[model samples]
Target: MEFDSEEEAYDFYNAYGGRIGFSIQKEYGNKVNGRIISRALVCSKEGVKGTDKQDRRIFSVQAIDVELASDLRVLACNAYELMGRKSSGKESIGYLKVDLKNYLRTRRQKELLYGNAA
Candidate 1:
């Protein structure tokens, strides 16, 4: 595909991303005489998966359970509820159970490391 201008390209990709349930971002541009000559648009989620960022959120939920001695199920429910509020009817993710399991395993490792395990 070809576009007459960078703005037009951006708008086209942005709309495409919206239709595909993601967002587009301007990655970078080549400048010549203070004018954008070339640019790249990409999905906002590019190169972001399998990172510790989302794990950090899970750790936050783990903190709540540790401090309040809360039930894991309730914590998962509340976390998913909050995530859903930010999205539409679609759930935050399908990995809540896996996250909870990771949290429990991590907590056990920590307890063992700090002599808190029974």
Candidate 2:
């Protein structure tokens, strides 16, 4: 079940309805190969909030039902590691950031209107 790349992880998340959003960062030069990658650690916003701190909320690429999950995890981890490099290029960082921000804003607005954090 260990994923060999991050794409598998991303696809899995997407299939499971856990993906909020994703984008690939743009690169002008060819020094770094352009790769389709996810920029954020995203999950289903409807899941149990408190469970994120427990084992149930942990993101595991190796625990999937398929064999390529490990590779996906590795790819995601590598993307995160190289995210700050000048030579490296991103493909989805912008979209991911925007989605996260909008999601947060919506959540806050709902909380204010409902009077309960939910």
Candidate 3:
């Protein structure tokens, strides 16, 4: 559940996302001193393509800190599991959004304790 690098986070999420009927996209925030200051994973429907924000759903990974990336990955996987239990697409996505918010809160707590290590 813990990753030492962003690549590991991506690999784990992408593979799991594929298995659960979604695709993961990496979104980077502004840079600081040539290093990324923030990062997130956007999990959308598999094969859905477009720049339109409405066409896809997004999940923030909270990967700015290497240490917290593992937590974020666990959160994502948990959301995926919650999503898998739903029979309806809309219902599943709704579950994911709610679960993601709770996970984000937990990630913030970890960030406060550990500080960003990027």
Candidate 4:
């Protein structure tokens, strides 16, 4: 398929995704100088997932999923603490807070995208 502009391609994909009961997102792009030469659009759920840093881990520790915060304000407050007693009452931080934020943001984006889908 060919499009005169990137916006045209996006609009085409977005409309198609709406009809197919899914969401579209800009996946990747290649540019020459300052102009975009190519663009990739894909389903909202498709992407490189967050990965655990294996090299730094001394031993395998089973992670317990916990609801850290219900709202944005609480998440902001709790983001600073490094490995406090939260999960299993153990003083250990599994991952960096920035990684957690990114994970949440990605998850929230997918939810919003699919929730609005037709």
Candidate 5:
């Protein structure tokens, strides 16, 4: 899915069981190259200017696949077409919220009926 804003992108990742933490590694001189690269969608807020103040609001989604530009473009275009709105970030947030709510309900049911994941 396309993401219009960065926060929405992060929220999507978080919904996918991705955690924010640290990874232990060789700190001194071991630099991993291709093994650590991640492809993601990015969103941005545009800035508006005025004499005193300006409303700054814009959303963007980017897909990175150097050799698969056509695929990425198609995906983005389809997402836009499907959403029927310009904000992909908003769509991502809505999806995440729905998923999280369902997850919480299932977790509660499991805890009430049985014991929890052992």
Candidate 6:
């Protein structure tokens, strides 16, 4: 689903993750030019290990601008789709592929539009 703010996005996932068999394991703050511009919600199976690592699956939400934020929404939705598919199949690691896709898409788009927005 589309979110109007980063907090809303995070809240939605955090609140529903447990019911869906995963939980928010970590939150990542993203900076751009020394300013906080985005946040990522990391999720894993209820009993998964090493959740506090950089290699976990995540759903990112950005507060860059209207247009860019819309892109971020799309990325988040795509991540949600992957999470649903993988969780349903009981393939925890498979979800990371979707996270990687979103991450790469976010990076490429930010580079092309915001240049150094990382």
lDDT of each candidate versus the true structure: 0.56, 0.38, 0.51, 0.53, 0.33, 0.52
What tens-digit string does per-residue lDDT give for candidate 2 at 1-118? 3355666655665665534454332122213446533333344444333422222221232122111422354443343334424235433222232333344456558778989754
Tens-place lDDT per residue, model 3, 67-106, is: 2534556555554543443323333232344444555667
Lowest lDDT block of 10, candidate 2: 58-67
Candidate 4 residue lDDT tens string, 1-118: 8899999999999999999999888754544444666566778987542344531121112111313452334563364352233332222343555555655566568778889522
Per-residue error for 110 in candidate 6, Å, reads 26
By lDDT, rank the candidates, best first: 1, 4, 6, 3, 2, 5
Give the alpha carbon lDDT tens digit for every residue of 86-118 in model 5.
Answer: 223333222222333344455458777876643
- Model 4 scores worst on lDDT over the 10 consecutive residues at 55-64
lDDT score for candidate 4 against the true structure: 0.53
Candidate 1, residues 50-76: lDDT per residue as tens digits? 534344234343345433433444464
Candidate 1, which segments miss by more than 4 Å at Cα? 47-118
Of 3 and 5, the candidate ahead on lDDT is 3
- For residue 19, give model 2's deviation from the true position in Å: 23
Error of 1 at 1 (Å): 3.2
For model 1, state the Cα shift of residue 17 in Å. 1.0
Candidate numbers, best TM-score first, in rank order: 4, 1, 3, 6, 2, 5
Clashing pairs in 4: none
Q: What is the TM-score of each predicted model, taking all chains together?
A: 0.37, 0.24, 0.34, 0.40, 0.21, 0.31
